[model samples]
Target: MAERADAARNRQAILQAADKLLRDHEPGHISLDQVAATAGVGKGTVFRRFGSRTGLFQELLAERAARLGAAVESGPPPLGPGGPPGQRLLAFVDELALLAAQNIRLIAAHERACGADPHSDPTYQRWHRHLRGLLSELRPDADADFLAHIVLGGYNGELVRRITASGGVPRLRIAVRDLAQRVGDVD
Candidate 1:
């Protein structure tokens, strides 16, 4: 039990170090050696724990996504909980737009480097399906899943690209609000 606890602590330390470095430098620029050195561990330990750079990045993304999930869980009203379904939908897009703005570069690098199954990820899949369910509750007439995908694809997915192209967040929230109103008004 003591050994297990020590191992867990060591892993957390390594992850923290890696996360710091990733935030400080571009993901591609940082190496496993830096991560191990920052964590005060041997390079072998990093390899043994994460296998490769891609694996480490995956862990980092999972860690970030976990934190993101927690934030959504405990965040303010219309996001965490306690709001009308339509409001919640808009909140999701607004929050997602913010996240993309914050992590645009790292995310672009991650998308290029890892290119893994985005939908297969549990967190993403859950959010996608949950939004569909909520949209259905908010508007029973439309095809919930398709409509959810359209909104996410049209509004959220384009946020990073639009921000990069425009050099800002733009009026994303307003556009999303208007889009949501239009969608909700559909019979």
Candidate 2:
């Protein structure tokens, strides 16, 4: 069944409201009531649409991840599939670092949304799969699975937040790039 026009509009409004709020406030500090008010929809509408605070934030993270996924699928190198494996792997890790630094709050919310086992989250799984595939291509003899997980560990959300808070996004980017380079390059 198709969604009604007003329902679609409400969903857009609610999503926009959440995006706007995230610019200035952490997810924990923002409320569904505030979202509904900014969206000009009823509080129940927000609740019914998203189920809970985590649900709402999860949807937001999913939207952003989908955009990144699309770029990785078809956009230009070194992010897309069209580039060399080593360069593409470096580019992908750079992107992840940037995501962690720029969207720390959303990352925290997403971490919470996934509870204790974030490795099982679809977003993280997608990233891991992409990284593993690229790592496999870059270093055929290396353990791509473990390598991908280790790459992700370096930009763990809380770690990125702390690093970025201390004004270290540039260093983080460089370190991640160097790590990817070293891991992909055979001695």
Candidate 3:
């Protein structure tokens, strides 16, 4: 389905405003009224576009995450499609760490507000699956699906813990790369 020109414009406006708000305020602090004013649209329009504040936040966060994903999918050799398997795998973690660090509060709040539908959202499941596929490609001897789950789960745990700590992201990225290498090297 395609959006009409006016609908597309309005959606962009709202997303832009939400992006700015995410930068200025924690996700816990944003309200629909504020988003409406920021987007220069009416409250009704906001509701029409997004059923609730949570919905708006979900869309915003998903959009942000998708943008990061797209960058990793297309922008560079290691992160994208050109690098060797090992380099690409590490690049995924490094990119994810950067994204998590940047949007930690927003992500945490969304996870809380959204109640985190594990095994439901394709995004969550896709990352794990993709990771597993990559590892499987690199190491044909291992149980790729299981390895993907373990590695992704561990990386996410570390990401949540370090989103705000001093130098947490950089250190964690290094750890992630080392861990990934170890997983790959296991033959």
Candidate 4:
């Protein structure tokens, strides 16, 4: 029991250290040695906990995706349950774009390691399903399923990072709002 508890503590420490490193430096530049050192654990501990750098990144992305999912499912309005469909759709897109921008490096690393399409990610699937439901409400006659994919396309990590790098998140938010407004309109 004590050994399990220690393992859990070490895992948390490694995750926290990896998160800090990802945020402070480019994900491509981070090494397991750095993470182990920062977490005050042996290099073997990190390998035992996560297997590889790709595994570590997968865990981080999964953790972040779960938090975003919880926020959209149960948190306050606009992103959550209480807003009008159009408003919620707009807020959701903005939030997704912001999230992608914030975690671009980590996300890119994960995609590269897995050789997978970003649209196929579990997080993207949930957002696509939620947006499709909202789009159906906003425009009953439109192809909501396809439109959800279209809306999400605009929030691609590289695009969000490029646009925001030039003008910042406020500009990215405004662009997302404009895109949402266009999609939200039925006629």
Clashing pairs in model 2? Answer: none
Candidate 3 residue pairs in backbone clash: none
lDDT per prediction?
0.67, 0.83, 0.72, 0.81
- Assess candidate 4 and give its TM-score to the true structure: 0.77
Cα lDDT of model 1 by residue, 1-187, tens digit: 2558766777888888877786788656787899899999889988888787666766766666675566556777677667777777777777766666666554554554555654454545666776787788888988888776666554333356574466466565556556766766522
lDDT of 4 by residue, 90-143 (tens): 778777777877787777666655555566666668888998999899989889
Q: What is the per-residue lDDT of model 2 for residues 95-185, given as tens digits with 9 covering 90 to 100?
A: 8888778778888767776676778767788999998998898788999999989888877778777777776789779777887888778
2 or 3, greater by TM-score: 2
RMSD of each: 3.9, 2.4, 3.3, 3.2
Candidate 1 residue runs with Cα over 4 Å from true position: 1-3, 29-34, 47-55, 71-76, 154-167, 170-187
Q: Write the per-residue lDDT of candidate 3 for residues 153-173, one digit (tens) a residue.
A: 544433556633756777767
Model 4 residue 161 CA deviation in Å: 1.9
Report lDDT (Cα) of residue 9, candidate 3: 83
- Predicted candidate 2: what Cα RMSD to the true structure? 2.4
Order of models, best TM-score first: 2, 4, 3, 1
**TM, every model:** 0.69, 0.84, 0.74, 0.77
